[model samples]
Target: MKQHHVWTWPIAGYLFLGGLGAGMSIVCAVADLFFGKGELLGLAPLGALLCLCLGSGLLIFELGRPLQFWRVFSTQRAVLTFGAWMVILLVVFDALYFSFFSGWFPWSAAAGARAVVAVIALLLGLGVLLYTGIELSSMKARVLWNTPALPVLFALSGILTGVAGDYLVCGLWPYGGPAADAEALAGILRPLMAGLAVATVVSLLLYVLMMYTSSNPTGRTAATRWLRGSYALPFWLGAVAAGLVLPLLLLILGGMAAALGALLFIVGGVFLRFLTVYSDDRRELAGERERLLKLPHGDEPFLKSNWG
Candidate 1:
């Protein structure tokens, strides 16, 4: 086994992106159901797909060996990973959604099927977020990653980031202002973006609590690094100040303020992922070192052999 540690960047960025994608997807889905459909949500539907596509591509990029990578998903898990069912479903969802926008389907189709689709999407989205969370929590080497709060934290971060992604789309395209049929998206941009702001605040509060309240030293120390140490600038300034705060302000004060806020949110979210991925990887390595050090060794072995 390699002594020291340096994980791939894809693991870091993609995990954060996956969680964010799931979170926002669900939020938009739910909001669309309860408060009526947000056409801006149409913009977000593709985030999970994009995140998954990019994430998978990044893993391939890191590996540079498609056959070896293909083999991992080719086993029993292939059905789950590369199965035609999931791909087909996502494609259908993507297609119908696009068709609605392109006038391929009647407006009646979007309004009619949206409620049911949102519910299903919300459940699946949460599942995706949870899977990312469980992966982190299950890593024995990274004691800091093995916390109860990981899934929720990841999911929340994903949601915040996902919203940022959607706003980015709106900012660049300006919804209906563009030649396309995104005019429907204009109405929901404000509220969908607002929901993203809400998710960010909620995620930040939860993270603060998760850090300080950890029962073990590994968990606490890891959180400390993220909240205060090496990762502090991105965590505080980028994640909180720019990502969360600025977006909230735009939400409260619309127009160019919201556009500016959206830009900040996307940049901030991207930077925040770096902080989280690096911090988590460090925590894992540190935890392993601490444990190995505690093992009986040299003269200490004899004395520590039997418990009194």
Candidate 2:
């Protein structure tokens, strides 16, 4: 079957920004309790809000019409319904929690209320993070997205990005005050970055391997696209090399390198989502492609729409 209405750049932008927001929400919560008092506690929630708004806005933009956007909420499709609701809940929870941190609410001084809001926001944040992957993987039309590893891979990537974001905010913004506070935060973040980087690389490899070996020919095609097709350059250079490798190397050097590493990691994160959207848009059933290859007619159509 011919492909139409393919996912494009908007989808990629949504996935990247939404994943960053979700990851940041959780990181903010952890920083709130762990550090007790720091710039991150305030920055994380604010950053999350900005990311979520921009990400969600892109989703609406992808719908291509204002009137049709509301249908996303009423849709019977599990992916749409679940993702929309999760984003909604995340926004509500994070908004209230951040309001408390911002001291806009008089009851913000109450530890019990803060604790409850923070916990709920963190859970919703996680839901938002995982939903992005689940939504993509649920697309039966794309063999590459059907794997169970996609959700896990996205989650690990989100965690890595979230930590990187925190490191950047704390290092550059320095709300905690004094060089010593930054040093203390760095001590905590350095090893954490190392661990997350390792996990992200492993998950990425597993995702590629699983998709490559999938029984479906379409699945294999999807894998090939990522591995060696038109997407090869962006996948290798943008996502793998710049996104993963360089960040890990810089992070190992410690100090300001962490900020540089985080920035590079964020770039990688964006490119990774771009790879996902563009790669799947090119996916075609492998069996169908083989049949089309045997056509007695001109090879122009076959070559023009080559599955690979």
RMSD of each: 8.5, 5.0
lDDT score at residue 288, model 1, on the 0-100 scale: 74
User: Whose TM-score is greatest here?
Assistant: 2
Best by lDDT: 2
Off by over 4 Å in 1: 1-6, 31-41, 72-92, 104-120, 167-199, 202-209, 212-215, 281-308
User: Which 10 residues in a row give candidate 1 its minimum summed lDDT?
Assistant: 170-179
Q: Candidate 1: give the clashing pairs.
A: 19-158, 20-158, 142-284
Score candidate 2 by TM-score against the native.
Answer: 0.85
lDDT of 1 by residue, 1-308 (tens): 22333445776766665665665566567646775544545556665667656765665666657657656544464323532233334434543443443344556355667666666667666666677666666665575566666666666666666666665554232124343434344446667667756766676657755766777666677677767877677777888887778777876676567667766766666665566555553344446777777765576566777753
Residue 74 in candidate 2, Cα distance off native in Å: 3.6
**Every candidate's lDDT:** 0.60, 0.78
Deviating ranges (above 4 Å) for candidate 2: 1-5, 34-39, 75-77, 171-178, 281-308
| Count of backbone collisions within predicted model 2 | 0
